[model samples]
Target: MENNKGKSEWVSQQNYSESQSTPYCITRRYGSLTFEETVQNVKNGIKKLGLDLVGEFDVREYLSSDMEKMPRHLILMVCEKETALKLISNDIQMSVLFPCNVTIKEVENNTIIEVSIEDTDSTWSSAKKKEIIEVAKNTKNILKKLLDTIEQQNVKL
Candidate 1:
């Protein structure tokens, strides 16, 4: 019932004067993640990360209806930007993103982890798209560092 568009603005201004920008959600605009197992996979990933992830079947359903499709999962988590960067970079292969169901955007001081079971068919601006990809790469690197730091700390502990 509530509109959730444009919910991806960060509080702090990022240095983007010379930064390459790319529009997110470029590929599939409409699709469905009708498989229950896919949805659970997303759920498990979020939970495993210890994020306060919640299921939004209603929102998913609503959006699916409006867009004429449903994503596998819409996992919402409120974490620091640094933490988000870490999570995105955890897996080197990052195969979790292959399904084309993930949308990681900063949402009003919060990071939105949109996991779709189905693929999307939406198009975005080239600059914005480039920016999104860059963000993903950065996130992966940050996450990798975070993991290494944690592991080192654990060893000390």
Candidate 2:
């Protein structure tokens, strides 16, 4: 698939090698911002996009109690109530994947943001599958926009 410049890429399980079986996740790399700044930008973008900031967990901070050392990493939970309700109303099992997850972690000189997409595989009706795909696609697009906005803002800074 052709990737747009400076945008997060959707990585489905099909994209992985046979040995790997991870679910789909969208990832983007930010080269111009620090971990804190990147997190802030993401928060701002989420609000601008009308998504709720459910919570943010600082992984590194949580692990510090165990004397474990790691680069700055955060997991942000965001969701749109209407979309979530529609999705669940279509498939109750989808509740396990509710409240989308976005991870930001420091890597070398850049910060990597990863957003997990709902698994669309199931024995649901064709129409149900279509609804799930549509919701996932819309969610992915919003995340891509959020990342793009952050990049653009950093460029202007």
Candidate 3:
């Protein structure tokens, strides 16, 4: 890879100082698909969900990372959810849907400030597929609820 560190001003630099945050902008409410389609599906999902697209990458692009091997590929997006809510409740459970690689990184002003869950793979078996659907549905509901809560908090503030 070319010294993309500061050469391409267009691509934001990755900051290693802060804790990695989950990709909250794109909700799996609709459900999960194979790794091959997750990137495109996430792009479409973010648009449909009315969330902002901070940055996204296909599997090939992510593989270029300095890491020895690219584990899973997950389409990343920016979310205004935490901006509204002080924090995401711990009681809320998150689970994998399909068996594929996925990760979430937070970015600010185009720079990746934090990375989370790098190289996670979910196995997609017949039963796992069904479970993944449910997981995705649950994820959608949680995000919707979180957004609603954020809105309510904003209204109160």
Better of 1 and 2 by lDDT: 2
lDDT of 3 by residue, 43-99 (tens): 454456555566555543654454333334444544434421311222122222211
lDDT of 2 at 149: 74
Instruction: Give me the displacement of residue 133 in model 3, in angstroms.
Output: 28
Evaluated against the true structure, the overall lDDT of model 1 is 0.34
- Model 2 TM-score on a 0 to 1 scale: 0.71
Best candidate, TM-score: 2
Q: What's the C-alpha lDDT at position 131 in model 2?
A: 82
Write down the worst ten-residue block by lDDT for model 1.
Answer: 116-125
Query: Higher-TM-score candidate among 2 and 3?
Result: 2
Q: Which sequence of candidate numbers ranks them by TM-score, best first?
A: 2, 3, 1
Model 2: number of clashes? 0
| 10 residues in a row with least lDDT, candidate 3 | 117-126
